[model samples]
Target: MRVAVVVMETSHHRDTEGRRHIERLAATLNEAGHEVSVFCAQWWGGNASRFEPDEVTYRGVTVEPAETSFCTRLPALLAKYRPDVVHAFPTPSSVLRAANAGAKLARAPLVVEWFGDHEESVSARAIGTANQFVTPSELVQTELWEAGADSDLTTVIPESIDMDLVRDVVPAEEVDVVYAHPLDDSANIESLFLGLAELRQKGWSATVIGDGPERDTYERAAADLRIDDRVDFVGSCDRERRLAIYKGAQVFVQTAWREHFATELLWALACGCIAVVEYQAESSAHELVEHRDRAFRVTTPQEIADSIVASADMDRRTVDESLAEYDHAAVVEQYEALYERLVDEYGLF
Candidate 1:
């Protein structure tokens, strides 16, 4: 089967969960004997408006930039590629419009991966144009249904992690808590700082991974809480380093106000860390560690601190076992089945 994955940017240009998801999907499809191509902007070289076309092979997937602009060049690109199915990531209204036009022009089924919330008006139009919808969690699917999308055409497919990256490292002799979240407003960094302050007496240090606009603000807050010395702001690091941090830490806390899938939470579980996630409206962290023994959902800073203290001596084997269903291989098989079903229904073969 020939598949065209449409996204605004690739991991080559930006490192985002959405781009990684698309790349992994493309790689998995290619490995499964399917022809896969990615249509995106040449964001890596900072040349999105280059007159000449930009093309490259990234992780065994062919990436072709939409040269003129996604809106203007996508239709022609789709016509040339002639894929059996067009898989588009939910980006912006303009891009989704282009993807819809391109899919229509190529006479291929359109599958839109809705990862985040969009304006209701824009979502209605995009959903109307898309043939199928794929969301990472039931919370997102519910949003699509409320936007007038056909429930039958929408499916919940959870985000997956590369289990091979889950290294078996012994926890460091020193007790440390790990919090891996982009220091963004949505991450609720304030709550985490407050929680860490509450646990100051426990003498357990913390390593806060990831970097963002709110880094300074959170750092200031940590100082105000008087836990600055105990918390280390390591900023962003490579995947290997992140896994090592998770493996060495006794607990992982997620204080995000809302998350569509909470990939980091899943990663912590896979790395054998005691996971504690703040319960939010759209959080899927509960899905990963349903049992209270493995993970806890907290609502306040006190609860967060308390959960960490309680989970300090817990075993990580059960939490790791719970993530088998979200392994990359299992996720790839689900996507393959979805693609085959869509292809047969649309008579694309």
Candidate 2:
């Protein structure tokens, strides 16, 4: 199957979770032996119209991130590419409409990926443009439906992880608890700190992974709470290192105020860390642990501290086979199946 991915910008242009998801999906599809091409505003230097960075082909629809030219030129390029399916993003709203025109011109099925971080008004205006919609979580799916996407036309596809790495990486030095996320205001790391502060007498150490503008603020919070010595703020680790940390940790604490999908929490769970998610209205972290064993949903520091202590009694594991359903290969198969079904329905074969 051939897939033409339409986007105004990519992770290279500006690092964002949605862009990262799209880029990873395109690479995964290409790795699965399907032809994949991404049409976006050129981020590479020089005047070349096309660039192949890895397995995926990135075709520059415009020299820079010019919204108007990108919207104007994308249709012809996509039509010429003649893809079986046109996969698009709903960020600027205009881009989806442009992609819709291209999909119609190419007679290909249009699928929109709504990652729940964009404006709802734009998504509401653009939802009807695509033949199908994909979201990273049911929370996002509900948001998509509320934004005028038909529930029948929408599906939830969780983020994928390299399960082989989870299974094979050697565990890092053991720690009692772990937390991972960019240290921003939304990180709410204070919740974890307050919880840990309550257990200052307990023999538990934590490793906080990730870095951002608020790193100093979080570190100071740890100090004010007088738990700085026990918590290690090892910033921005690669995936393999994170997996090793998660594998070695007894508990993974998720206190972020918002998450389209709790990707790091999923990684921690797959690495066999007990999930202790603090409930937040906007975050979908709680969804992953609903009705699951060794997972606790809490609302306060006291509960978080209690959960961490309880995790000590649970069995230790370096990997959980049950989460194999979210392996990269499995999620790519979901995309392939969705594309196949849409192609069949469109009689594009």
Best by lDDT: 2
Q: TM-score for every candidate vs. truth?
A: 0.84, 0.97
Residues 278-310, model 2: lDDT tens digits: 999999999999978989999999999999989
Worst 10 residues of 2 by lDDT: 118-127
Using TM-score as the measure, which candidate wins?
2
- Checking candidate 2 for backbone clashes, the offending pairs are none
lDDT of 1 by residue, 1-349 (tens): 8888887666666666666777777777776677777777655444343322223232111234443355787777787788889998776666777888888778788998877544324556766888898988887788878878899999988887777667444434344578877878787877777888888777778888989999998888889899999889999987777877787777888878777788888887887788788777767667666664667878888898888889876764423655777887888788878877887887854
State in Å the error of residue 26, model 1.
2.2
Angstrom error of the Cα, residue 176, model 1: value is 3.3
lDDT comparing candidate 1 with the true structure: 0.75
Model 2 bad stretches (over 4 Å): 119-123
